[model samples]
Target: MPRTLVIGAGVAGLATAALLAREGHEVTVLEKGTRTGGRAGVLERNGFQFDTGPSWYLMPSVFEHFYNLLGTTTQEQLTLVDLDPAYRVYSEPEPGSAAPHPVDLPRGADRVRQLFEELEPGSGPALDRYIASAKRTTDIAERRFLYNPFKRLNNLAVPEVLAAGPELARLLLTSLERYVERRFSHPVLRQILGYPAVFLGTRPQDAPAMYHLMSALDLDDGVRYPLGGFWEVLASFRRLAEEAGAQIITGAEVTEIVTAPARRRRLGRGPRRVATGVRWRDEHGVVHAEQADHVVSAADLHHTETALLGEADRSYPESWWEKVTSGPGAVLVMLGVRGELPELAHHSLFFTRDWTANFESIFGAHPSVPTPASSYVCRASASEPGLAPEDHENLFVLVPVPADVSLGHGGAEGQGDPAVEQVAQAAIEQIGQWAGIDDFEDRIVLRETIGPADFAGDYNSWRGSVLGQAHTLRQSAMFRPQNTSAKVSGLYYAGGTVAPGIGVPMCLISAELVLKHMRRDYSAGPLRTEPQRTARQSTGSRADGAGD
Candidate 1:
């Protein structure tokens, strides 16, 4: 069996290792952090458990599909509670108004249609048409694009692509903002439709209309919460990996990827350099080098390229990285409040009247400190009793901020507590008035805030971006970084930073893409006839023209 080394125990890494191990490869996973999940980690403090990242569980079917691949179901391991009244959206009321306009989003399509009709007469049917279009986009993605790596032009010529190519092409040409504005007359409904673009790490005006598929996932399938928190999902990934005979070692920070001159010659030419092993340091400061037939980096792509591999060995240069647009950073405030927040739903969105300002502040050319008029609040304890003590609430507040903002005096190493506190206070005060939670700050028994700097220090995230690279039309699909490295043989990548793009579901798909390429390349021999660099150049041209 080929010995494979996977760096990082994030969802992508764990999934890759498990699948590879099942395929009879000797897999070993190395994680820099002490825990399994990278961004999707959990923070447990004083009887309160908080999911540090990825609070929204939007796509249940994606999770189900992954679990089913392992010959099991997500239901077999964890109880998933589907959230009813999917979420609540609170809009700052007009001048002279006493309360914010609160709109509770119901689960079923008929209920949502009714809610739309109530909000704006004649909008019910409009919403139905919009959702249908979104669903069609989703179908195109799921059938033609999501699974395939798009290595060659032929990969785009599938039967599903042939059937939905025209509609998909038209959707890709439009912007999400334009699509929503054309569909919804009500401001609240427009905000609701455009909100998912934030998770994609781009403003609605900039992101492609193809992203409306996110609304389909929200309205059609519904949002869900795992009983014990998102940590349970990570635990499940770890469990499956271990059961498949993949050994995961946490607190093992990989410093370098060791390469050796490959013995196998291609076309009677000189042997190429191939990744043979990795050097990592243990928790106790002991250094070790483990040899492997292949190396898969599921860590931060920028870190993997610049740090682990030498500068000379990088496929993407500094210039290419500079050109890449990173996703927005977030100010996450986790509060273990002393009492119940009865007015708030399991998921809530406090939207501002001016949605464009919120996007501009974060995704602008020279981003400033975000004075977000909108914020998201997740009251996990509202649905999951195990998350906090009885009569108490566990609140997770997220404010999208400029990824380029400096945390001030303390430097990037600091968790940006002062900055977080300042933002958190403002958000709490605003949300309190909006939700009628008087003395909300006073009820907090514990508070922890994670900022952009924290993301950089913790995960080595580029620009301290929480969602990795933004899925701009130029940066998406084949244009994104390839899973297979052009500079190094036996080196592969799988994560949000690479193709298939961001989100937890994307991470799972990324692993599968990496495995697909690995199998195709390494099936018959040690190397392919075509030079990896040459293939990359050819593919790069196609990628550039792909958007056009």
Candidate 2:
């Protein structure tokens, strides 16, 4: 069997290990963190459990399809429940209103259409047309784009792709904000359609209109949640990877990717090298080196390229990163409230009236953290009651800020740096005011905050970016970083930073792309062959290559 070493224990990392192990490879996964789940981790405090990342679980079909590839079913691994009112949108107070205006977006297509019609009379038809286009674009992306390895330009020029050439070009050329504003005059609706761009690590004005397909996932298909949390989902991935005959070692911090001493020179592209193994340090301050035929890094691409590999072996260097646009850093406030938050739903979005200025403050020429910032609140206990104590609620708040670590990291309340604490306090106040909660601050039994500096220290994130490179038109699709290293053979990348794009579904597709490219299969669709399944042995050890 081919010996393979997979770096990181993130969704993409575990998924890649599972896929490769199933293909008869002797796979071993190395994670820097003590536990599984990179960003989608869990924090337990006073009987309350908080999901530290990836609050919303969108795109059910993608999850289902990936499960099927593992010879399992989504229903078998997860108990998914669709959220009734998909979400509620809360906007900053209008001209004379004392409180913020709230719009409830219910589940189902017809109800969404009706809500649009009610918001802007005679908008039902326009919404229907827009939704149709969104659905078409989403379908096209799944069929001919998301799963593509981009190894062959011919694979992208298929009949279905050629048929939508004009439309595709138009969407690619336009901005998501421009596309939404052109169709909808309602500020709330436009914000609703455009805010998905934030999840892509770019403002709607910077993201290509092709991302409008995100609306189809939330509005048309409806929002759904796993009963437990994303941590549970990660556990499922770990289970699959272990069952597929892969070994996972936690607290193993990879220091360097060792390559052969000599590089073969190419005629014009300069010297090329081949990966030999990796040097890593375990938790107890011990160092060891392991050899493998192949290495796949699922850590932050910038960290993998700059920190792990040498300058000559890097595909994206420090200078290359300087030219790239980073996604917004964020201040994550996890609050364990004393009582139920009846006013807030499972998911709520707080949008500032001056939307453009808000985005500009973060991504423009001069960046500063915005006051009265637009934020997202996820009440996980609303869906999974077991997450909190009997009468309390769990609140996970996200505030987008510039990716500057100078703002500082996070800690327990009043313990973090001044800038980080100030932002967290402001977000709490904003949520209380906008959501119409009178005693919001008083009810906080527990509080924790994570800032850009925390992301940098914990994940070795570049620019302290919460997401990878922003999904600006210049940074997306073929323009984004490819999975393989140009300078080193047998080295590859799989994560939000590389192809297909960010989000859980995209990460899963990225893992598949690594397999596809490794096997030299570049078909622009999900793999169809039965995954080679070998006999399994579940093992995870802190010691190098040792099974427990």
Candidate 3:
């Protein structure tokens, strides 16, 4: 059996360690913070609890696979309750308009269709058609497109994947805005259908059309919350990981990576020099070191290379680093209230008054403070009262902003106590106006704030970015950081910044891919003199290949 060391105990790191241990590898998960979830950490204050990140559970099938792999089912670990009337959108009635109407986006298809029918008689059928098309695209993408380990565009040699090429191209060019405009006449419906991409760190205009599939996920699967909030989901993972005999060590920061020189033999030439062995620092100032047959780093790629690999290392080129680096950071607010918010649904979106201008401010013009921008306020506990104490509520409010490429207010500086307070007050006020609660401030009995800077300080998220790289087509799939580092022989990557892209499901899939590779390599035994065939060579045609 080989010894394995996994850096970072976030979802990806934990999942990696758990799977490896279950495979009988002596695995150790070292986390910098005192907790395991990192950004998914929970905040508890005055008998109220809040899930700080990933409030909604959309692609539950992914979580189910993870649980089943570990010998437990989703039904046993946590209860996923479907939220009806998923969310409400409060559009500031059109300028100088007499009517005051807010959009109530229901959870399932039948209700959503009825809601659309109420807006425009024929729109219900259009929505159904739109969902059907979206589902078809998602099927291809999930079953085919996403499975390309992303070695290169040519890696997808499967027939079904190639056959779905036109679908991908169509989905790519079709903007959610234009698609929604073609289907719905109501401004609110258009905004609702076009809004989910905000989490992607780009406006709907820049977001690829394929992202509409994400919207379809919400509409088809419906928004769900675990009985104890998203934190409970993490708790379930922690329990399962521990049950699998994985050692989880929190408050263990890896300060340095130690290595030894070795020789690399060429195909026709003599041995070439190379450095090997993995080493890092523990939570205490003192250093600790261990040798491993393999290592997996779920942390930021840049940090892994520069800090761990050091200078003069020739693992990846500068061009690859430039392409897979950090993206936008976010400013988030968590609140606990005295009484329940009656009007607010499980989720709410307040679109910026000027969508185009908002993008300009975040990406182009830049801002000095947290400005009025598109925001998502999620009350997971609102739908599942079991998460909060009697008569109390838990809420998480988030706003995405540019990364701290500069020492700016909206990025790292936004995590400061003063900035957090200002942003919190502003967000509470904005939510009050949107919810039409005149005295909403009076209901707040508890409040806590987190921002991109917190991601940097607590989680070591490069540039304080929560979502890793931007989700543009250029930054996706094989274009994303590879699961296995070509530079470091035993090194691998899993999580938001790597292949298969971000989100809970993607992270879980990434872990599975890593495990699959390990099992394949381990069962095959030592390497042969001849280089193993690439994923492309191994699978000759598209029809008989994996992921097709």
Candidate 4:
């Protein structure tokens, strides 16, 4: 069979392996981490379970569609329960105000409109129009933009793109902040509408107005939480991939990609180099090599290109990455409190009145400076009963910071660093006051923090960025990294860094895009039955090919 080696066991890697294996290709996945999930990993400590990353499950249809492709339903795999209040937003009190303003974003569109009307009279109708426009953007994106790989200019000439050209142009030209300002008069309402930009790791003013579709998806479709945690979704993907006959090896860090010169006489005018397999080291520090017909990198795109493939085999130059605008990194604090926090919901956002200062701090000129102006808190125990001890809560707090800030590798100085501690203290104090928990710090029995430097060590994230490249107008769609390698044949990439951009839904779509490109470029033929040969054996006894 045509053996394929996939790097990383993240959502994209697992999904790609599963889909390719189902297509009759022998697939094997290599994961550097000890667990299957990359950022969506689960952590258990002191009887409290926490999701390390991706707490908000915004797009349900995406997960449903993935499960459906595997001949099953998301309902069959995991029990997905809608968070009733969706989320709660707490704004810092205005001058002369007695307390902070807390807005509960309830499920259902009519109820959301009611809430908007309460905030600003006559805003209900405006919200209706805004959501309608957002829905149109979503429709156009799903039908025309998201599904296609955008590998060539001709891909933009489709009928759907032609039909939505005018609306798309308007959305592309406008900024999300500008759109929200034009649609809503109230500042709080504008913040609520524009806050979804952070999910894409960009400021509202910098992100395209088309992202307002996120608000429609959030308020109309509602947010969901898989029973147990977000980790359950990773488990489901792992199970599905394994069932599809794909082998996954955890704690196997890939050192280099193995490639050989293509047989020019047999395949005319193909690339000079073709990927043969990969060389990786296991947890025990033992080295091993696996041979395959094709290789897919679902790991960090920058690491895969520069670190594994080296400068000579890279399609993008060092200057290209320098120009890429990466998304914000984060400072995450996981707390296991001894008492309940009834004021907090399944998800909550603590926003400061000075949104501009906060955004600038995150995406500013001097990124290394720490800013703890806003925070996102996820009290998963509010919805899931077994997540924490009785009468206690599991709190996951994240502060968006500039990707350039350092917290020492693996958070070596996280506990004692003055800057990191300052941010954590600010977040804790704000959340405690907002939730009416006066003794919040004392209630914490266990605490863990992850900073940008930790993200670098753990996930090899570029500049410790939590998300991949920002979805700026220039960094989006066809402008993003291509799925196929330009310098080497049979080498492909799939992840947040490539086309379709960031988020779990995008990762799944990225895998499909890679598969589509692979089929188109290599031609859909039956798997070759010849046994895989070592790179040394195939390359005329070149023993040097054995090591990276």
Candidate 5:
């Protein structure tokens, strides 16, 4: 069996370790942080608990599938509470006017249908049809598109599939903005279509129309919150990994990789560099080296290439970093409120007047926060009441910013932590003005902000991007980073930056893709038999005698 080392202890890294361990590989996961969750870490302050990242869980089937792979189920470990009114969307009743206030749309198909009808007469039927079409897209993408690595376009060349043409093609090219515009005339409906792209890390106008199908998964399959907090989900992964015999080494930072040089005595191929081991630092600040046959990096692609890989084996032109690293980043503000705001739901989105202009401000360096910028507010206490003290709440707020250095916002070269706080306060002010929360600031018991610099320093993420590369057409599917390294043999990638795109589900898919590649390359690995445990003869004393 090949010895495998997985870098980063996030969901991607942990998932990879779990799968590899199950495959009978000696797997060790190295994490730089104090714990394994990475951005999905936890924070506790003044009797309040907050899940630093990934507040809401959608697509329960993905979690179910993950659990099933381990011969277990999430139901056995944690309770899954489906969020109602899935989220509230605050959009100006008019495009640019501040006159009409926000509306809280409930979750589920019928509720959404009623919402559409209330907004504009006769729009309900159109919405129903839109949802039907979206469901088809969701089915096709989940069943066919996401499972495979999408290594080549020819993978779709099956004859029967070709006969079922124009479906995926049409969905891929359709823009979400256009779909919403055509479905309902109400401005509220347009705002709802735009919400999905925020998590997708692109504007609706630029996001592929096929992604609107995500609404079916979001509104239909439903949004859920784990019982304790999202961190509880991470804890579940940790338990699964340990139970599967995977070793997780937190606070162990790997610095460099060493590869074996080619030897003329070799039989098969003459002189090829093979990875032999890696050098990492333990908690005591002592450096140590260990040998391993394979290395899977769940870290950022840029960090893996420039930092870990070093001069070992060059992958591509250094210029490739320029393109891959320039994805979206954001300014985040997390707060612990004094008392619960009964008006808020588990998830809420406050949209900007001009979504395109807001992006342009960040991407094109328009210099200020968008006049009516968008903000995402997640109320963790609503679902899991114990996260905070009695009657208190935990708010995880985020405002997406440009990754551009020229924008001169909250980062290393700019105004620093104070700037992040100012911006967050401004966001809270706007949220208050729109949502009618008069005591917004006073409710803040404790608040902290993380900007571009924090992203780079804490997680080593490219330009502080919470999500990896932008999901532009040029960066989607096969065009995205390959799971297996093209230049460095025995090296693989699995995370938000890879195929099937971003989010928790996509990250899980990435881990599966890496395992598939490993299984193909290393034939000596465990056989895919019962998948629970391998049967082997034991070397204990014979049944008749015990050294008598």
Candidate 6:
């Protein structure tokens, strides 16, 4: 069996190891931290288990597909609980209004349509039109672009894709902000449609209208949570990888990817790329070298290219990143609250009225944390009470800021670096005001803040970006970095930084892309795996990433 060494034990890395191991390759995964899950890590404190990363579970079919590929099923591995009133959108107070406008997003398409119609009179038809367009774009993206390896242009020349040329062109050419504004007049509705851009690592104004597909997932599909938070999902991945006979070792920090010069396969071609092994330091700080026929770096793409490989073997060096745009950094505040935050829903979004100001504060020339930053709050205890002690809540607040580690690192309670504390405190205040949690701060029994610097220190994140690269038209789809290196033939990559883009589903698809590249199976769509078992009935109550 050919030996494979996968760097990092993030979702993508574990998925790749499991898939490759099933193909008879001897896979060994190296994780820098003491535990797996990479960005989807857990924080346990005083009987509360907080999911510090990637809390929202958006795509169920995608997870199901992955489990099927692993000779299992989502039902067999996961207990998914549908979250009613999927999420509540907390918008800034209306003129003369004493409180903020909180819209509880309902489940199913018709109710969602009705909610929008209620919000903006005579908007039901326009909302339907938008959903149709989103569905079309989503269909095209899933069938053609998301899984396409870009090995051949002909791969995407299917009849439906050919038919969508004009519509697709229009979507790609326009901005998400323009797309929403053309259809909806309500400011909150626009914010709802535009916010997904942040998840993609760009402002809505800069993100291509093609991403309107996110609405298809957000509204139509509704949101759900895995029983134990995202940590449960990570546990599933690790379990599958182990069951497939892949070895995973934590605290094995890789020093360098070993490589050497090699002769070209054809006389006309340049020197053939090669990665023979890797040099790493184990938990004991002892350096060891291990040989592998293939090396997959699932760490941050920029770190893999610039830090691990030699200058001679670098496919994307420092000069290349000078032109690359990083996504926003973030200050994540994890709190174990004393009481049931009845005012807050399972998921709440505090959207500022000045949406452009918030986006500019993160993406503009002089990026800084907005005074009343638009943020996301996930109260896991709302759905999974087991995550926290009885009568308490496991909550996390994410405030997007500039991708700069200089803002400082995180620490326990009132001890965080001043800048990070400023951001986190402001978010806490904003949440209390917008969500109507009168004594939000006083209820906090535990507090831990994660800032941009922590991402750099823990994950070697380039520019301390929480997500990977910004998903501008220039950095998305085929425009993003490919899975394999142009300079190192056997060195592959799998993570949020490469295509098909950020988020958990994208990372799972990225793992499959590596499988496609290795086996030369460059089909346009995801490979079909026979159904292992039909998903059973619901039991309860859902990014590959650096520090989600």
Cα error of candidate 3 at position 469, Å: 0.8
Q: 440, model 4: CA deviation in Å?
A: 1.5
Mind sharing the TM-score for model 2?
0.95
Among the numbered candidates, top TM-score falls to 6
Off by over 4 Å in 2: 261-271, 529-548
Which lDDT values do the candidates have, in the order given?
Answer: 0.81, 0.88, 0.69, 0.82, 0.72, 0.88
Tens digits of per-residue lDDT for model 6, 319-380: 99999989999999999899788788899989888989888889999888887788999988
Instruction: Please give the lDDT score for candidate 6.
Output: 0.88
Q: List the residue pairs that clash in candidate 4.
A: none
Pairs of residues at least 3 apart in sequence or in different chains that clash in candidate 2: none
Instruction: List candidate 3 segments past 4 Å from native.
Output: 93-99, 151-155, 182-185, 261-277, 314-326, 365-370, 405-415, 520-548
Q: Model 6 segments beyond 4 Å from truth?
A: 94-97, 535-548
TM-score of each: 0.91, 0.95, 0.87, 0.92, 0.88, 0.96
Residue runs of model 4 more than 4 Å from their true location after superposition:
95-97, 265-270, 368-372, 409-416, 521-548
Could you give candidate 2's per-residue lDDT for residues 133-232 as a string of tens digits?
9999999999888898888899887888899999999999999999989989988889998999999999999999999988998888889888788998
lDDT of 1 by residue, 1-548 (tens): 99999999998999899878877899999998988899998878888898988878866666767766665565565666778878999887667887765899998888888999998999977888888988887776765567766656675676777788787877788999998998788998899999888888888998889999999877877777777777888888899999999999999999999987677877956326789999999999999999999999999899898888877678876767988888988888888888778789999999988878778877887676566558999999998877998878888888887775365211222244677567777788878888877888789887778888888888888888888888889878777887888878899999999978888888887887777787773221111122123223433221221110
- Candidate 5 backbone overlaps, count: 1
Report the candidate with higher lDDT, 5 versus 6. 6
Tens digits of per-residue lDDT for model 3, 203-309? 66666778887777777777776777768778777776787788888767776554444455467342132323456556666666767777788776667766677
Superposed on all Cα atoms, the candidates' RMSDs to the truth, in angstroms, are 8.9, 5.3, 8.0, 9.2, 7.5, 3.4
Q: Weakest 10 consecutive residues, lDDT, candidate 1? A: 522-531
